[model samples]
Target: MLYFIAPFIGWFVSGIIKFIINYIRFGEEAKKRIGNGGFPSTHTTIMTTTTLLIGLAEGFLSPIFGLAVAVTYIIIIDATGLRMHVGKHAYILNRLERTNKGETTEALRESMGHTKVEILGGLILGTILAFTLNIIFKV
Candidate 1:
């Protein structure tokens, strides 16, 4: 049960935190726009949570735990590297698509990736949440 729900918990909590942060930093306009690229990447949070939970439930030396760690590493790397570049490209394209009159004909989404700090934030949150849950439920 814990394994099944840990990722969801991590995602929901990370998303709530991201939403609150966005609201505080960008105001109501941020609320009007719903997209990714925020502090504490939910993708990282869920993967980290899954990895940690697997390490806890199955021994850290177990093959499944090793697989979980590998998957988590891949996810984190993808979020910080490739996806980040994609977001940057989207930003540039969006700017390029703007007309002389300051009206954008078509705007590309720029929230496709997570920054390093965002990934770190997710890592920390996931670690804490996983340990807490493990302690409480012994899973």
Candidate 2:
């Protein structure tokens, strides 16, 4: 039970901390209705945390390690590429709407995702958190 709970708890705590830090650093700018990528990505946090825990539990040299790395890469790519592209499109749409005398002006939800730097930061933070926890708990 404890083993199962560790990753979840670590993810939750790390996510909250990241959210708070993002809010503080970015102010209201960080608040978004829909999207990802703020400071430390919750997605990265949970995925990395889970991956680390699994690797520790199973074995880092096992096939699962490759799977986890692949999954993490895919997620980071989606967050920075696809999601960021959507956000840019939304911004353009918003601008076009304003040019049309506000008739088509619909506030497309901004912050569809994180910048590349933000995603990189998330990756680093998640990796550190996972490593630290793994070492501390000896899991």
Candidate 3:
């Protein structure tokens, strides 16, 4: 229960703070923050937070912690690698489609993965939440 709550707290905090900051700095450009792939990656936030909470609860050297790390590594890699790759392709295709005028009815999704700064934001948020939850719940 603690692990579940901890990760969610991290996700919420990261999303809210990033949204507000982006809104302030970028104005309407910050609209991207409302969707996927923006200043902070919510997927990374949730995954990292869960991993850290697991590690804190299970002991850093424990098998569970190792498993958590491995799983998180794969997830983060996918978010930054394959997911970003796909998103880039989508952006390209969408731009190309725009040239076709009425040929395409739907727009492709451009936001799918996090930039380095976005990933870092998630990591920081997750770490803070993990520590806070650990202290509060003594997990």
Top lDDT prediction, candidate number: 1
Q: Per-residue lDDT of 13-93 in model 1, one digit per residue for the tens? A: 988898898889889866744556788889989988888988998999999999999999999888888888999998888
TM-score of each: 0.91, 0.76, 0.87
Put down candidate 2 lDDT per residue, 1-46, tens digits, no spaces: 5457655765676667766776777778645532455666767766
Best by TM-score: 1
Tens digits of lDDT, candidate 3, 1-139: 8875766687788779878888898898787547667767777778788888888778899998898888878877888898899899999999889888575767778778778888887777777778877888888
Residue 49 displacement (Å), model 1: 0.9
* Candidate 2 global TM-score: 0.76
Per-candidate RMSD, Å: 1.9, 2.9, 1.9
Error of 3 at 125 (Å): 1.2
Weakest 10 consecutive residues of candidate 3 by summed lDDT: 31-40
Better of 2 and 3 by lDDT: 3
Off by over 4 Å in 1: 100-106
Clashing pairs in 3: none
> Any idea what lDDT model 3 has?
0.80
